[model samples]
Target: MTYQNPKNLASIKEISARLDDPNLVILDCTSTVIPADSGSGFAVADGRGAFEAGHIPGAQFVDLERDLSTPSDHLLFTLPSAEQFGNALNRLGIGAESRVILYSTGQPGWAARVWLMLRAFGFENAAVLNGGWKAWTNAGLPVETGAAKARPAASKPFSWTYRPGFFVASDEVVARTEDEALVNALGADSFRGEAPIAYGRPGRIPGSVNVPTSSLVDPDTGLYLSQQQIEKIFADAGVKPDAPLIAYCGAGVAASNVVFARTLSGAGTRSVVYDGSLLDWSSDPDRPLVTG
Candidate 1:
């Protein structure tokens, strides 16, 4: 049976049934967080160790920091150039016809991060695995150990089409007009400058409303809430239904989760992720941040 492309989120059952489809490409996009030696904030580490230990059968691993992000002296996961991203996809054997499934070990944010990256690069056939690795294991799905077998190169190099507006920089965020809604995806504590961990500075972009990524998912299942529930969360948070949205978190990773949930709730066309997010925003003393 042929694999059917999911709109944006796929379930474990959907993937388990398509294990034999040649056109299917499953990616483990896990990245773990470690406490920085300074002991103030956190640092990110590649999940190669976790992936090497075990992962979904036939799933290759994609290191968000090393494989997908552009190397930057100051930034963490800045989006790479179109050509660079295209080359990476080609190396993964992702072709125009491939249906990609992305999942992470912990939060779905890691998977959503890659999903947004794929969409920004104009690849529309990718989907995030709902509930991710945890849900899969809970269901007793088959898993494999050790490194992934090298993927066969795509028949032709991936043709990249850059889609503007899916990812925006700090300048666009700074230039946001009154009509635009700036949404913070960080937890309420961080947003309110009460968290022990601060990204440069606690607090959020001035005038941004909170729609914490945590609120978008079921605490027990690790799966996203129903579409109606998500939409209500947005509305309750004062997110305008029709206004353009700029989503951000400490860095850009969690913001992708918010963007993904918003999209799933039928309000994604007007949403964009601030790629640099608060990491860039808070670095500049000149940029204003508001605390409650």
Candidate 2:
């Protein structure tokens, strides 16, 4: 089956060929998340060290938590204001005519998050590198080491157009209409509250359907499943083929993968990521959560 939105994904071959395109801006959006020492949740770590060790030639590293997200004392990966995001893009030399490709050394979710952010900010020329760094290396592609070279400025300034509905708040999730589906992108163990680790609470948002991001990719290849396979996964998860979906996870990172997967599957469905997700929901005792 053909992808519903083919432009959202880039193949390793396409990326390899475009390595020297003046308008191409490749970003390594890798961020490692390790289990917190306290043993309850996860902590975000900069992927610069890994990128410095080796990366796609001419590709710059993006610290998602540091470069793109807003500063939050309690939450991780909060959405940055349009101005802040625009400035970050400027520094990276992205412009109106630029083609941005995002990839991660770890989970594809890290790269998807940045892709979602760019989409939300009205940048339409960006795509996520399928299979990310794993596929690139497994294919024996050339790698570069050392810090990223300073990016030359874009010929034209990046125009910011704030789009609504790409990200929703907790209240929006709470007030979701019946036509909408609330999907949890965390693993089944977390969805069932059986996992030893949790963001804040051990349960899922009340009435959420499970569609873990991990299920969207081929385990062995680190590439997304075929379009037909992904569509079936969503249908099996109780999501109506045409229903709008509100996807959420620990701190809204994994949910982006869900959103991206839905697009890649050619499901032609509208999906939005809950910005705060479980981290925001569980912090408030008044909110309700359910566990199997």
Candidate 3:
């Protein structure tokens, strides 16, 4: 039986059952993410090579860097416009009536980023394949080797209507200081400045609390912790369920997982990822950063 879990998660079994749905659009968001400490000067590694090598049946490759981000002079993690994103979706055979499922080979953050992006653009009928590629293979699911393929018929029309307010900037974070709680989606070391190697600077936004993406997921399985476990993790950090939150990390990638977790943690909390993150925050001489 085909089924979708809360927070837009699709079990491998659910997707396997609906492998023949006409309007089902599956995207392989598999990416090699090099962290800030990699010294490569780029946070994201090219994932096309992996996608082109082998992918799930009826899956298309979604290039996060080239397709989702626009060229900018400054080194910031920014998103593309509605038109640009729409065109990318169309090229992948996605349309208004499609149900998109995204999955990745690495951490859930990569898949979550794509899901969060789709929601920001007003398409909420998308899910991340829980447990990702590993889970599928572990479960002995069949796989196809070769180039990417789109599930929807080529003749299907594609479109996207933009919806705003899925992300926050440094200015807005400052403006909403008193209202929204800020969560640092980084390891405890990075959150506490001990892992300065992971970021440009050694501190965090003054009031942000630590909620490492690693904690919300199981490293061995790539599956998320139960909703109760996730909520307790946040609640233990003093994050209020009813209040809004902002998630940030070294380059804003891990923050996506936190936002996705909040999406799954039930409706009382709404979280937005700050794309620029601490890299943008610490770059400004005037912004304050704190460390223990």
Per-model TM-score, in order, reads: 0.95, 0.98, 0.91
Off by over 4 Å in 2: none
On TM-score, who's better, 1 or 2?
Answer: 2
lDDT of 3 by residue, 174-226 (tens): 88756688899989888888773545578789888899988987788988888
Rank by lDDT (best first): 2, 1, 3
Task: Put down candidate 2 lDDT per residue, 133-226, tens digits, no spaces.
Answer: 9999999999999999988899899888779978999999989998899999999999999886787889998879999999998887788888
Best by lDDT: 2
Tens digit per residue, CA lDDT, model 1, 196-291: 777887788898999998898888888888877888899999887787899999879999999898888777448999987887888899999889
The local distance difference test score of each candidate is 0.86, 0.90, 0.80
Residue 7 lDDT (model 3):
44
Prediction 2 TM-score vs. true? 0.98
Q: After superposition, how far is residue 160 of candidate 3 from its true place, in Å?
A: 2.2
The 10-residue segment of model 1 with minimum total lDDT is: 1-10
Give the clashing pairs for model 2. Answer: 4-266
> Best TM-score goes to which candidate?
2
